[model samples]
Target: MADKQLMTYEVGEQMNLMALLKNVTVRVAKNGKQYLDLTFEDQSGEISGKFWDASAADIDRFQAGRVVRLAGKRETYQGSPQVRIAGLRLANADEPHQPGDFVVHAPMKASDMEEQINQVVFEITNQVWNRIVRFLLAKHRKAFFSYPAAKHNHHAFEGGLAFHTLSILRLAHSVVQQYSSIDAPLLYAGAILHDLGKVIELSGPVSTQYTVEGNLLGHISIVDGEIVSACNELKFDLNSENVVLLRHMILAHHGLMEYGSPVRPRLLEAEVLHQLDELDASIMMMTTAVEKTSPGEFGERLFAMDGRSFYRPNEPQAGGPAVK
Candidate 1:
């Protein structure tokens, strides 16, 4: 008998259906088609599945971000392995762990990402900006260190918000410094502080979910309001235009009303931050999704990322077919 490759099942492995699924989100498909679509992960990474006739009774048992067992044969679509459900149900606490179990992260490593943020902070020479940055970084360390950038968008892994935000700001600063026409401190500060409110907007990894505060007051307002309060405390010697400009960058980072920004990027620095932030985040999402996908196959459809499908690159040639 061919040993099943754990996550990659062979023809007739006695796999437990409920043990292999992760982030199992069940919902009604179009035209009343009972369906379930969710990612199944192993140590190798995550892959998604869609079941056409997932039952209503079983639907209640499986929820988003929950693991379940499956007893089914492995099937492929477009060269991707998908589980055709012979049986499925909720995985109990005491159920023996399976080899190909999927574990979802709480965004993506916020603490290490925060250290990257501090690199940008140390570069600022403006004392007032430094104080404001310190206060928020200190006060909201928990949220700042843990929250996902969005509920389902890019950087949705553990500590993903912090990692993405820091990366965007750092990259943006590098580019802006070349011109020297832009104020380095202001632009970098704006970039670093741009997504500070995300801590409150989303929950941490332990919970791996959103909170009431997030639903009501979003990251934009939370961050904008915090910046205003921090400025008041620091007694910043800023003209109204400077304050407004910085605030606009935070408010407009989302870049569109439909997307979430109340105001668009108005100033040069604000425009730069918005564009760079978007560019970094989008690239990260696409690249990470691609990495999780199998080689010689197109990746799963990313709904939050405009339903864009990505193709995994073919593996490099194995040095001319193994010289004997």
Candidate 2:
């Protein structure tokens, strides 16, 4: 098969544009006029292109998430590449799409991330916390297996949200170990359940778009409310203090009220969990954003996460002589 990894191509660059390759999403956009939105990918990266004047017959040939080939012109639009479609058709059923063609299989493997999460779950000794973890892990297995962390933000890949949450909890647990006064078990539990409500907040698989409840109730409210209800049903001896502490972790996971946190972290465990969550999320976003761009290249503006474009190269030394 021709290399589809080079999804990004400049105008006048001669390359075979095959749509039949795997992990491609095809959408139609009538921007001023009719255009085919070709979302193609390979192991290296994925790119979106516009195919102007795409015929209706071609449009009928494929549905969303189907692989197709494009034979047309490639041009740059505001620094990003777009394809002008001359021809497009679906691939044979026997033809397999490359796993790397989709964002799910882009940089990180979901299995490894899930394995780490499983390891963390096994480490929990508290029976109540263990049961809650098991219930969530099992109930959202399918979605967690295929969902992205966000529609377009950090860790937005299959199993990403769970993977991200697990990492945060792990780090938070490690950080709190230094403080002897804090309850490590409760803190660990809080970290684990902090973002469970995300299962309801964001849709999974094809898109990680926010649901109506996510937009209104938000993850904190949904998670805290669910935890309370579940604890009530199971008749767990959830002390009011512990309940409040855990709820605070969820409610303040976002770290700031303006960012949707119901309140700032007050307790030591909640505060630690909040900081760890923020640290993990922000680092992931920055790392992923920087990695996607070429060395010395400035990343394209990230709207869903970081608002500004980031330069990829390390800054030059202040006193070093300039390169010849």
Candidate 3:
């Protein structure tokens, strides 16, 4: 029988892990034999794995979105971590965990995030923007709190969409405090609506992927279209100054055209929104990478950060538990 006790993944150590098959593909090795290339994810993080010389039944047994117990030896190839699978099996019904147990989740509960976001919606004093935001928020409330912000990278977990918006809101408040010239209501409204289109862009939390609309139009365009629709539905002029400014914030949140923003931030509030959004996302991505790294060493390279690998400083904080 295969080992039931799961252990941590460390190079030169045998790993007995219960993980979600986050991604699975049947590929050919150099010898022309088939192999199962897999991504195994647990509460801790994810790692690449391969079941070499896969059989017909092996292909049938392993699949993405399935929970499995894996027995493998962790090793490095070309400086990247990978597991060479020796034994693997589908998780039994009687196992203590399930697929949901493996996918990552935001720190805040969905209910809490929704409640707090609802309050922030009211904080948007511009009645037109407030009405548009309320209409859209109500329309996509379920997916807003349930979808991940991205298919991967920072905040690619359950409730991450809402959590990420909330994080930006928190940052926006501080920015407003620091710079009195910034319009609080405009910034808040932009923060709320910035990534709301992701609900349409991404399929959902589990095995997240881009939807057809997402691939064709992208989130920025999708949300801008939504705003136009909401204006027509609510009898607000789509070309009005405030509506145009709000749309600019959404379209310019990416900060640059190459990154997908159709326009650069032209308003003061729009600029602040762009910077705050970038700040929160950068911090989240780096933090996620650091948490997965061993203390005193650098983490995997961040493709989002120009392929730079951040060093996980070995020194413990003044009050927190030391990183191990």
Candidate 4:
């Protein structure tokens, strides 16, 4: 068997390796010299690198998504490891590298996640909601499974959208079981379609960025519009109360107007959807932060979490004495 490729390398390590060129940009230094700022990645993780005093010819030769051989010294910048590239060139055809080895992916298998999500759709007994959810899922199944939840926030990896949606669906199922009054169909639909618009909102799975529609309308409005289009195609009544409620859930899933929800969640189902969405996103953010930090130390401040840092304890602690 071939030796295992490293997911990450240590700082101060001088090495030559093959990795995907995830991103590249050119910028001028203070001395009027140009440099290439690049991000390289393998299944392990991503790292930034700077090719100082790069020539125009060099820039022309490098492009994103291509596998390349890189020789560099790893160094630290602001507590993160980065590379100072000494040399770089496209990998030879004979090089034992596979594109799949360089990309990050969700922990769960994509096919398994898709199957589980389909099972949830099958459970939605409400005909109208069930049809709408199935239509949207079928229409965007490719992008839905391929795109990240965000460019660089929670669930920002391949298959993230489905992973995030499935996570929320699981949470909503428990919430509905606990609160019998909650509408199961609406909540399930909301969980699956809350971020459906992100398929068009994000550029793609690799080195993603916001598209024109994403930047102008955002995912909330984009999916709201999608609901209208889907309703038209399906010949569903536009003015039906069920349609309005579902649309409202998507519009108000952001929960607060300040957070970009055009309208606040007014219905009970909408409110629950918003809360569950927040719960899933917050948990992912916190877990990601904690995992990145060393045990017994505080993590870097998370700007999205109100700039609060999290602590990762070295030892697991049991719950305090149970109340009598």
Worst 10 residues of 1 by lDDT: 99-108
Q: TM-score for all predictions?
A: 0.77, 0.75, 0.89, 0.87
The digit string of per-residue lDDT tens for model 3 on 124-242 reads 99999999999999899999998889987888888999999999999888888899998898899989999999999988877777899999999999999999999999999887998
lDDT of 1: 0.69
List ranges where model 2 is wrong by over 4 Å: 6-12, 15-38, 53-63, 71-87, 97-103, 106-115, 122-127, 177-182, 211-216, 237-239, 304-306, 314-324
Off by over 4 Å in 1: 1-26, 29-37, 40-44, 50-60, 73-81, 92-111, 206-208, 232-242, 292-297, 301-307, 320-324
* lDDT, candidate 2, 101-147, per-residue tens: 44454244667666777777776676677666666667666666556
- Superposed Cα RMSD, model 4: 4.2
Per-candidate local distance difference test: 0.69, 0.64, 0.86, 0.84
TM-score of 4: 0.87
> Could you arrange the candidates by TM-score from highest to lowest?
3, 4, 1, 2
TM-score of 2: 0.75
Q: Give the C-alpha miss distance for residue 28 in model 3, angstroms.
A: 3.9
The CA lDDT at 81 in model 1 is: 55
Off by over 4 Å in 4: 1-7, 96-100, 315-324
**Winning model by TM-score:** 3
lDDT of each residue in 116-210, candidate 1, tens digit only: 78887887777777778888888888767666676655766556667777777768767876877777777888887888887877665432456
By the lDDT metric, which is better: model 1 or model 3? 3
